[model samples]
Target: MDNPYKVLGVNENASQDEIKRAYRELVKKYHPDKYVNNPLKNLAEEKMREINEAYDYLTKNSQNSTYSNSGSSYANNNSSADYYSIRNDLNRGDVSSAERKLNSINSQDAEWFFLMGNVYARKGWYDNALNYIQKACNMNPGNREYMAALQNLQMMNNSYRRPYNMRGYSDRDSSFCDLCVSLWCADTLCNCMGGGC
Candidate 1:
């Protein structure tokens, strides 16, 4: 086991409250929901494990034995490391290999699309990234993780300079509303011109 304080990102002499604060911040950053079905979910889980261990070690011998994981903590049923290793390989900068591995995956869910988008993004294939991330969003429109990935793809291209980059949206400048509205209007006009209505 690594030093509890170091694992929790706090000084050894940190007060219990200080340690708790650091742990909470890390939890917020690596929460499972934030990365649900993410290719990096495994990495986040590893981080959560470290955080859990640190909290346990510090709380077991401390006067304040009030430490608990804010959310579910299950280490037994984690996915095989083969999948995670493939994710890491993508992160290591190999799009072709990543895509090939992705092709072999049976669990093609939102995370899979998001990861494919990541590989495309790294290879400067913004168009492909956009398409894959859009598929991810379509798969899980309610999931903020997939939403964020699609947003990132939009922001990466054109820096959101022309339209989707509306003010108050965010640094990512992601928005399909404006584009969708425009396309809808165009479709409506085309329908009006056609006599096949």
Candidate 2:
């Protein structure tokens, strides 16, 4: 992987501009946001870690080093036994074993379904990824993790958009809030005037 640092295109003495550019480009290419319902977050995290390492390496050599990016800082530890098992299998490159482990579990919580969906996304089966993430979202409607995964799958088509343009529209995407974009203001007005409940 070409000096994980070099692959991210940063140097041991790169400027803040260069580091930010490299990180942004790589993050855009492998953003968890792009793969929300994706099974490939493990890969994305790998990329993130590489980018972070490259950034850290560069910053340390420079005069402006600040804000260390560490693994524990992400805090995505909402894991379970099955999730951990799946993670191990994935790290070991045993996708089938992970899938089998997932199937062996009886209780399907949001984390379980989300990780399953992530596995599917890694396999390039976006449809199944979508299905699993949706199930996860259903199990935990308020869970940010599940919701973020489900939304990520939905954003696949627009995943390449620049960060400034990347957005998650809940009212438009959520079934309960599927209000027409054009009539949003009018709808609000009507509801305020006691016209439509």
Q: Give candidate 1 regions above 4 Å deviation.
A: 1-83, 160-197
Model 2: how far is 134 from its true place, Å?
A: 1.0
Candidate 2: C-alpha lDDT: 0.63
* TM-scores for the candidates: 0.40, 0.38
lDDT of 2 at 196: 67
Write candidate 1's Cα lDDT for 28-75 as tens digits: 998878998789998989889878866765654343212223211111
Candidate 2 lDDT at 117 equals 86
Clashes of each: 0, 5
CA error at residue 156 for candidate 2, angstroms: 0.7
RMSD of 2: 18.3
* Candidate 1 vs. true structure, TM-score: 0.40
